[model samples]
Target: MPRNSKRSTSIRFRIARSTVNYFRLIYQTFNLDIFELNPTASYPEFEKGLLATLKPYRRPHAFLPRTLGFAAAIARSAKSVFENARPIPFNANQPLFVASTTNQKLAIRPIFDEMTTDSFWFDEQCKECVSTHANRLRIPFIPLVMLKALLSKGYRRKSFRHSVATYCEIHGTYLAFRLAFASSRPSCIVISNDHSAFFRTLEQAARHSNIPTIYVQHACVAEHFPPLNFDYALLDGQDAAEKYANKASRSKVFLVGISKYSKSENESRWTGSPKRIGLCCNALDQTASTIEIITTIQKSLPDFEIHLRLHPSTPASEVDKLIRKCPAGSVVRNDAKTVNSFAFCKSVDVIICGPSSMMLEAAMAETPVITVETDSNTDVYGFQKHGLCQTATSAHDLSNLIADIETRDRGAFRKAISYFCEGFNSPSRPQASSLAATLIENISNRQQIPTNWKQSKKHGWWRYSSNEPELEAETTA
Candidate 1:
């Protein structure tokens, strides 16, 4: 071919690759994932992490097929999506989406149930819930969005491919909700999941439509959690407020204590040396380590009765595996999922835990929780630094900590709770659910934000009040 003809063909190929798919993928990747950047890191470190994706060589072309394939699968999965889901819109009377976990559903319900506004419990299937009002969120689809996203570019690294696939999946998610919002608009949306793709899509859609978004803290967070960008956020305590403070300017943060609990419901501490111990493990823990933790504890504290509690996500097979691995003198139980965490806290004098939000929950219940690193030494929740719990590096360390806990006055835990929680639900103040529900109702009515939530003029963060009780004196480990 002539040089001119060859050059023309190359230009066409490049242009073909630069269609809507490539641009949208790049744009949304930056727009959405920027929030996921670590706020706790210093300026230079933060800048480096944020710009990693946007490096001149990322190409971003390989993302097209993954996004297109996902979008096509979604479209094909529900042949009559328009009939069963796509045409559907938000709950007309009270728009609520429960796209999070069963536990989050439990955390969010108390506040949602308090609202006179019509809302419904939603599971992943988009089925009509059994609420007094038949609340249903009709799944809606927008073909154009997916079509545009599928329009063309083509590969690089495996890790990069997986990351792009996830980001593209959210595009498909965002498009469906975008169409749904246009169908029948609601006054506001309430959510408890900030970490999920679906919930984040709904949040992004709601913001685009100028609809108010309310976030209730269903669980504890890490330093890596996205900033509080919701229009209204009901936080569990000061720990959360501080973690998200750097990026929370746009969000109105209410330091409502954990909404799931009502009144000061604490476990009754034993008057003498502890007679029972609970060993709790989450999915993050390895079975070998779990067995070792329990066996070591049993050997170290031979007189104490030990109960093993597996997380809800633990499979039945895993449970059986755990039971078989239990030490001869120890008792293995998987009933922790059936009973509430607070109830589990009450069942034992002290808890030896893996990295879980339950550490804080158990602490709030006045249960002495000792965290042990089962899989890795990483302190995911900062329980030890915050003074809520004692950290044990090994099974032996935990055994010694258990003995110390026997002699230590449990009142020292009260100060730790203050650092994390405004207060356990109490008669002295409104419950977190009530405060959050009132705020939601007021916002729905287009009324002024209640004066009780004050924004700091200096830092621009909102707080329910600064009248929190002073921290009790620090106790030695």
Candidate 2:
């Protein structure tokens, strides 16, 4: 053959190899592995262990298949279990989705078969198996309520077991709900007030259903996670919104106001003293370091009465212990009066917290605030720089900060708060709730795909401006 022919054949071979490699990469990127199972697969072993461990509590009828393939099929079948699981669209006359953990019975009723026995071993083993496999499996097996019920079966001595059981119950309920609603809902939006379990469920549901989901950042927005393919995100401040926007390139991100204390009912009750100081308390044992910082601040400001509100999740006994540790008349036990955090924020003059959403709520209320970071690993400079709150790193710093706050120019602090909140104090201004509602409506409206969209060869969701010139020229002349 001639030299030109030989060169052409060589080039063709190289091109063929490159094409094969490119196709292989694409296949690996999008491949679904639900049907694949190996001999060493942990999911099967976990299922066997879980079934064996939970045998005493679980009904005989609950045992169906022990293999991975069968479990995948059951998970797939569960997708069609509910056809009307989506939330009703919000209308001017209709009420929005209300948060309810109220009839816990409704969520726990499905696990009655697993609540019969008082075997502590069965409960402990079941919880261990569930926690070990929860993050690894696509479908979460143990519901959170079932774990809670098992805990109530009298194994209080095992704290880790009890905690894992509580988590599993919540996780299991979320998983069951996700599988049930997968086929019914076109999309879902999760509104959570800083609960990791709720957020995990939202992510799992979105991934399983291949549906668009949005997360409204309900607290400090600095916490980072690997960006899921969320359709949109709403943040508490512009700085946070911009950070996520740059990081999550595919998602539509917006800087909306915080959502707490937005209701007219709560706003009407904002009658707390102008200079009152509020200290939001967490669990004494879990946040012992935080409580120590609070003690230091109390000693520095003996004249300033600090109103400490216990977290709703903290037990009554824990609150009592915390009160005893603090000076008399320094701790305020208002946990019973308010059902939600926003309601509690209404009566606070100045809020102090440790990476809590209460700090953001205080900012939304246009109140001066301080955020303490006891952990050296956590950075809170963004919160301080944004004028949302003053960041204190130690007990000594907090004590000095409290003293400084008393002498600081009140007018300057008010102006800083106003700038941070973007005029939230104005009587005519709409609250964060209204802003959230409006943004949701707008996004939902734009989410509709065109009827002939399938016929078009275009790849993206948006129209290209470059195509505009061609259409304009064709129509004009």
Candidate 3:
């Protein structure tokens, strides 16, 4: 059997085994009365159907005499997902790639490895290092396991994979994909951007792939890197373009902003008077220090009503503990409706935050904003260059800045908004998106012509030439 096909078969067998094992565990742990919840009935049915379907196929692991081993693996994978809450979309034949700079082992690789099966691919170094980490942690070696599964399943497909380790590596990854395309051809590519790497990969991927290369913008673009190019860049607003207009090249950036926040029919139950003081809590990173500055400001302005917006990653119990440490009536926990920091920006008068994208979102909402920047520990490229928010250098500075902002004229605040967001408008403004789309479409059209393509030598940073034919000024945007 072909490598890809064999890998797919092995994955199917293992998944079937795992599904059956998971169902058995659920039954053993919970009573029949617990299982009677109709809303949860589909899960059990799906598990059973998956198991029955796989029973006729050969099992991937020969050592496992029964389906119990598969069940254990399923339960473990499920536990991992519940803990992370990050969805891992899987496809047996699709080319998969992960772009990240952090050397630490990621939480999402299991999902991707399983999805790849025998047709799987990744940076060999990353695969080796991450596989070693998994082994050390006693996690199942799912990459090879999935490869075996895919082999049994008879999956045959071509996949090209790469990564962008840091902001600097984004361009290199793009170049690598371009070279890969010039050699071995692939159908399509999908670049997943999670804050750190920026959109450089998507731009290069579009340049290479004969088919559509989708861009899955992982966070609100305004809060992330300066925009570059993307065939179809997903976004929640024009705030990203406004904040990084100088950096954002023309591209077909799409606004499917926060699909999770799409309106539902259900009405909220609670209605209360708006509070005066608001706090945005974040991780202990440099960005979180902005919260510390905001907290200091709230202490001096004792009369203002304070509302705390917690980061999604923070535990509720930790937030409650932080609240208990604060002065009484000075902090209020956010209701479910306004839990996300961006949700709070639209309702608040003044938003004090660190170098978070939330500050940009607040600017997009036309709210007065102050960002506290203390020690140089947490600096990003665009924070200073774009003038996204008023920086506070110290606690006293923050308090004084807040006081000034509180009394500043509306025109002054609007001027600050203009400084941060150059082209504030509705989300539908398509300058960035249109530019990106046109560039990619033109490149794709050029590839269709029968002209001989040329490859340029890869050079160092200073020596790198921007003289490629398609890389002219028009497509560079």
Candidate 4:
């Protein structure tokens, strides 16, 4: 097999094994085999049947309001339905990208300002703020059709919770995308992350509508998720490009540098005291382990202060519970809004984390990192592999790492971080926002081309190689 194929095969094996294990757990707990799908059924056939059965419930939605504005929007969209109107030409006249979040908006602020473009977000809370700044569209309700589909699909919930979630997402997002683009279609859709099924559906919908989608890397793409054939993917550095070059078309992959949100000072010597260590928290899964490690570190290095910086996505309640368990004045949680992650790096001498993109951010800010390896650290470009940071498999090992931290070679550490994370290698490296904007404009100005994954062989279910034997990997979301 080709190198890419081998890697993908390895990932497939892992996923299949995980699925089997999940079913085994279900069997052991409830003595049920509900995870089984029709072995010989074609995917299209199954989907067609499901959609047809649920189509009836879509009609007779009398509860939905028929306001004049809604009717007017539909009337306006009638032209697009019949004639298939083309997107507005890409130019400096206005923004052609639809940012899904406020952070994404700020990431490309340079492009948005320089091009005299418009931007919008799908968040309700950001509606007022975004409208005052740029443009904000109200999110549409999940159509009755999608709700009915989910209700019918709930019968398969006995199989796994993911089954229901996937069924709802694939349909709900499709409907939302259709409505969002019906009235005002942009030249392209720009999104930050590919982790969500909603983003996958949005990409599919955009392709169907003859619009291109661009994915700006928001984090490390290390997990075995479904293939997303975006028209363009802006990456952080040469390493990032190499990591995803096979996943996307080589032509679609562009090394546009690191995240624009990061403010890494060039040639900043980390002469700060090594006593202050920052612990970066990722998903809720790592909460317990991280707290345990923190406790161990506090006890080992009594004079050192350990600060916890929770991921923006992590629930505040999880942090509160974890903090209550820690010794008073032992671990302090950093407020995200008040303290920027890079700023936190500036304050701390070294940072420790699970598998999070913040490691790259911290590294960019010239903060040495020590990654704690656990069952959930699935990042392909893990810290230890790239020589960017130290790794410890257990709390005991981590305690030793902290004790011997002063012996690390700072000169070599800075070099490794710059080599792995683009833009930080030198002050002359290309900036992310400008590079991304140029690629976006270039793609939009030309004819829209289908992505490579659209033409390649796709696997069934979560979409892996169908012929490959099962192996061990993380379960699909």
RMSD list, candidates in order: 11.6, 17.9, 19.2, 17.6
Residues 162-199, model 2: lDDT tens digits: 13323333334344434334324433443332234434
User: Over 4 Å off in model 2, which ranges?
Assistant: 1-211, 263-276, 284-301, 328-330, 336-339, 371-377, 391-429, 445-477
For all candidates in order, the CA lDDT equals 0.64, 0.45, 0.41, 0.55
Candidate 3 lDDT tens digits, 180-257: 444444333445553233234334444534445545443433323434444444344345434444454554444333
Top lDDT: which candidate number?
A: 1
Candidate 4 lDDT tens digits, 362-466:
777777788877655644454667677888989889888877766777666766665455545344434556556655665656644323112222311011122
Ranking by TM-score: 1, 4, 2, 3
- lDDT digits (tens) for residues 264-284 of candidate 1: 565456456787888887665
Which candidate ranks first by TM-score, i.e. highest? 1
The local distance difference test score of model 1 is: 0.64
Residue pairs with backbone overlap in model 2: 142-172, 143-168, 143-169, 143-172, 143-173, 144-168, 144-169, 144-170, 144-172, 145-169
Q: Residue 49 lDDT in model 3?
A: 34
Model 3 earns a TM-score of 0.42
